[model samples]
Target chain A: MNLIFWSSESDDDRRDTQVGSWLGELDPGRDDATYWMRFHRDVVDGSRFELARRRQAAELTVVGVVSSWSRTLVPVALAAAAAAGIMLAQPRLDQVEPPILVEDVLTMGLGDPMPALFVDDEEGGLLLASEIY
Target chain B: MTSHQKIEDPRFGDGELVRRAREGEEEAYALLVGRYMRPAYLVALSVTRRHEDAEDAAQEAFLVALQRLEECRDPERFGGWLMTIVRNRSRNLLRRESLRETSVLPETAKSGEPLPDRVTERSELDETLQAALAELTPVQREVVLLHDLEGWKHREIAERLDLPSGTVRSHLHFARKALRGKLEGVLTDHVKG
Candidate 1:
């Protein structure tokens, strides 16, 4: 006879209970409990970290990679910052600009609209954009 | 019905932990997660019926629970509340995933290939157990896993699940019976080995 509310007596039934217990393994092991602890610590401390960087750098300087999804998720703040930097470095989309010729493309990064001296084939030597006809 | 507070000497009660967590104490929140992770996962498995989806749903639910800590009106019953989040997350995952894929037995297991080591045996056994668990009703699965696996009392399961204690017992009795029937060979071999 089976007793639900009492200690199970039958060993076969006991073993069955263990089989049910084994399903707990489907949860990530206790290591995840620790990993998430550390991850939350980093989040609380305002220390930004990357899973890929932790792997490449040979040291978990900030947060450790906790799971498989670590490889896929870039730190959103880092991605946003990188994107913003690239956008700022590029010319404003709203501004009208000349199409990039070879020399103009080469000179595009010199500075913020600085008067760059490029070799002028028409005038034969280094001349500022203002000096060019 | 007893809370895990009575099962083990956790340093703080769920109400206290929830309060501390809401106050930005990561340690308290981590403790809560550690304490309830398995129960949360089991609850998720009840709804998802797939280990992978259950794991995702459990983790997502924990995150969501943490985010909405303020909304947990009854922090003392945090386990019950978290289980609700887990169930909702699992159902939402099902709705979103639309039954992605069933657990297929590993190729080696299906081919009758020799399991070279203990690792393979455990892996195969785990999948088999999952498949067997799929046969039980959702409530039965939840009751059995919580009562048998997590070692919760029948009354605790009843309170958490909002079922009568007697009903919880009946579910457990029948769930174990069903599992015994389906897992007879596997369980016998496991018992012997």
Candidate 2:
């Protein structure tokens, strides 16, 4: 997995804040919590250095883990989700919305909310949107 | 071979380096990377107009160049070939990430003021040049930077940019004119100071 970090002014911090908040929702007791903490620390340290060098006012940084998704896993994930949905009255599978077309996603306005259907743990690690369906 | 040996050989030119690199010589490839990294970064920066993006694009271009080293017909012009890859990669990145969000002008331009008199003449000139370069269209900047800064001929720039030689000449002419117009005041001020 590759770790990506982005830093910007606080006024332009919307994207980082949103991604940070989403990551915060994950259970801290999970096995991957350590990885997230390390990623966060790296981001904070990197942002501090960058901000100090640039002398920018009110810097913010966001970090995320990105892993490649295998093509074969798509069908497997779909089958598992469908099976789990049929077994449970409240279908978590329904939460896995159809993958948005790349063109449609590209056309979306900057302010539009991105669909967050796929979870990162196919190989038990974070998968980027580009990596996932 | 040791780094000392690589540096010592007068006959070991770019073609020799390319041949060695093709034969799995890591030292030869490193030498090539060292030689071209700056120019490659400049080419990418001309397109992307951002330092970080330019660095990333240049690094990726080197890797791609290494992988496709066999495809190079003339090792003598490896710099131009690698630059072509860098240009394409930078343009592809610009397309993928909408340029509207990423194409920011330099900080000097955003600050919107000439530097104080205490600033060195060279520093002022650099800042003015940066700002003027930022003002140019991407294609114009690319042509001007390659031709003027890199000392590439119009034919070389045209081949890499995939434009006609006449168009490259035209772009270079207009870009220089625009730069001169933008910098005239700064130059005059510097001289008077």
Candidate 3:
């Protein structure tokens, strides 16, 4: 019953099965061996594997050396140069400007500092010394 | 240990080899190269048909495999992963050659020994098979080579190719059918000759 049920296979299945049988009957010793052996001994040997290997090794080495050199040396060298440059230019930066202060603003309002007073308005705010008529 | 025991692969039954390779064991990679280099080269040659191109593709494949070993989802499935790299590299090499040779040879001339051996009937069979294989589209050729020549199972082939098993089945079916037809045609000619 099971065989009967499985028997109605498609044309593709039948064809594939036949091919599979042919594939099974193929002697690996005679044809495949000769072709593979010849291909390996002759063609593969003549290829550019050696050149590629050397190139790969050189590329890796250069990358590694450059990476390490950059990691350790570049930062230290840059930092030292920057520090030296700043040391050389310190006085120039210092003489550029003095910061603003509260005393500077107060002196501007008082006009030679006669005496100072203050008052407050109901709506807005505080009035400064000269306006305290 | 007995010779039988000693003949057992040092890297077998342990994922340690993969771990070591990941940790930069060039020797472990060398061991892998020693193992797969021949088969990989053969596959490359079969696909590209050029001696120089095959060797370059095989070496590039091995290098790529080593570099991308971390992407190997299953450490034990390393061989299949390596084969995928070989296939991809060989295809890339062939594509480049095709582009370069387009102006020179409009039809990409396969690079095997052009003369068929006349001595043995078996050699004729090989020649026929080789020619038939060459006639296949690259996808069909790849599927046939992976499944028939390399002895990979459908599931394995599907996974390696990142295709569904059903698609792999369809490809294999068509490839084998095409090959059988080609072989039958050649056989008829050879018999006449």
Instruction: List TM-scores of chain B, every candidate.
Output: 0.79, 0.67, 0.64
TM-score computed on alpha carbons, candidate 3: 0.47
User: Tens digits of per-residue lDDT for model 2 on A1-133?
Assistant: 1222222222121122221222122212123434323433333333333324322321222211112234566778999999888789665666887889998888779786767755678578877677766
Candidate structures ordered by lDDT, highest first: 1, 2, 3
Per-model TM-score, in order, reads 0.54, 0.44, 0.47
Model 2, total clashes:
0
Task: Give per-residue CA lDDT, model 1, range B16-120, as digits (tens).
Answer: 988867755656766777677778878988888765688778877777787777789999889988998999999999887653323545567568775343244
Give DockQ: model 2. 0.01
For residues A35-125, write the lDDT of model 3, one tens digit per residue.
Answer: 4344333332433354345445555666788897899998999999999998997776768678878889777766565554766777678
Can you tell me which runs of candidate 1 are displaced by over 4 Å? A1-133, B1-9, B99-124
Q: Rank the candidates by TM-score, best first.
A: 1, 3, 2
lDDT of 3 by residue, B71-149 (tens): 9878776766777788789989878866866655532245533333223444565566667767766666666655665
Q: What is residue B38's positional error in candidate 1, in angstroms?
A: 0.9
Error of 3 at B31 (Å): 4.1
Candidate 1 structure quality by residue, lDDT tens digits, A1-133: 3445543333132324455545544544432545434433433333112222322443333454443246555576579889999989998877987677999888877877754466566657667666666
Clashing pairs in 3: none
* Model 3, residue B172: C-alpha shift (Å): 1.9
